[model samples]
Target: MEQREGYKRELYKHWNKGLDAGDGCDTRREVIISEAIKAPVVTAGCKLTGGSWLSPYDGVTVSDAGKLDVDHMVPLAEVHDSGGYAWDAGRREAYANDQGSPSTLIAVTAKSNRSKSDKDPAQWLPPAADYRCTYAAEWTGTKLRWELAADEAERQALLALAGECPTTTVVYGTAP
Candidate 1:
């Protein structure tokens, strides 16, 4: 894996009008709608007003769409460090706006998502301890699916977390 020294968030363009751009919704709104526990009311132009989201990271149930953020499971900076720096603009944009797979993006509380921003398992984990297993599995699956490489510390942390999650499993296809 490449060193994380000079990573720039701007390198990866995010929140593009996604695969369903024709619907006039961006990636964030699309994730919010998809992950909503209660279907959100979408006004014209895909403005979401009401929705309930179960944040898998902190295990919090959020009622307002404004309180949630669509998190990139493998953050853009981390992806760039792993292997995305070599990709062209089109691929990077696709990854940033990916909605083809459920694991690529998730709806979680804004607080939790910010807390986890761009940090790998070695640097951070969900505040909710019980969720670590699921978190680790998802992280691993995302990396494997995207062919991202983990550094030594990250690999160690993931291995340790996997030890605690004997029954947790992930199945992912090729990257978008």
Candidate 2:
């Protein structure tokens, strides 16, 4: 209750910081993926209720947990390299486990997740072209929330991917 809220508030205060005083710059995809698979948060529907597994990567539906991976929209490695080396472990863990936030912790296919392993937008992309716009918004939103900076190549790639989808003003909520 209050204790949880307090911790959340504290973490949010230093939300921009990540593991190992920012040295935890690598996406740590293996560790993150392994942990997420152990305890997955259900996906939400358009209205926010728990919905069936819908992978934005390939626009496929899968009910089997083994088939999914909880993707970090703004990859851990990218953040670590960008500035995560300065953050505390708690902040990094929260960012790693962020799920209540919209489009932050998506359940995508294992193949897609593996394909996206530790790479920024410049290195990987969704197979479903239509989702690129939403994906960019989600990625940008996470980075903005964590006060993270994107590499020049990643920025360019995101922009290019976003261009193919319908335009919408991107907005991110306060840190939880």
User: Cα RMSD to native, each candidate?
Assistant: 1.3, 11.7
Assess the local accuracy of residue 125 in candidate 2 as a C-alpha lDDT between 0 and 100.
Answer: 75
Predicted structure 2: lDDT: 0.61
lDDT of 2 at 6: 20
**Which residue pairs show collisions in model 1?**
none
lDDT by residue for model 1 (72-161), tens = 998999998998888888888878887877888999989998999889999999998998888888888888988888999999999999
lDDT of each: 0.87, 0.61
Q: Write the per-residue lDDT of candidate 2 for residues 63-170, one digit (tens) a residue.
A: 555566666676566667656556687766777666546555666788888888778888887889878778788888888877777878888887776676556557
Per-residue error (Å), model 2, residue 34: 19
Best by lDDT: 1
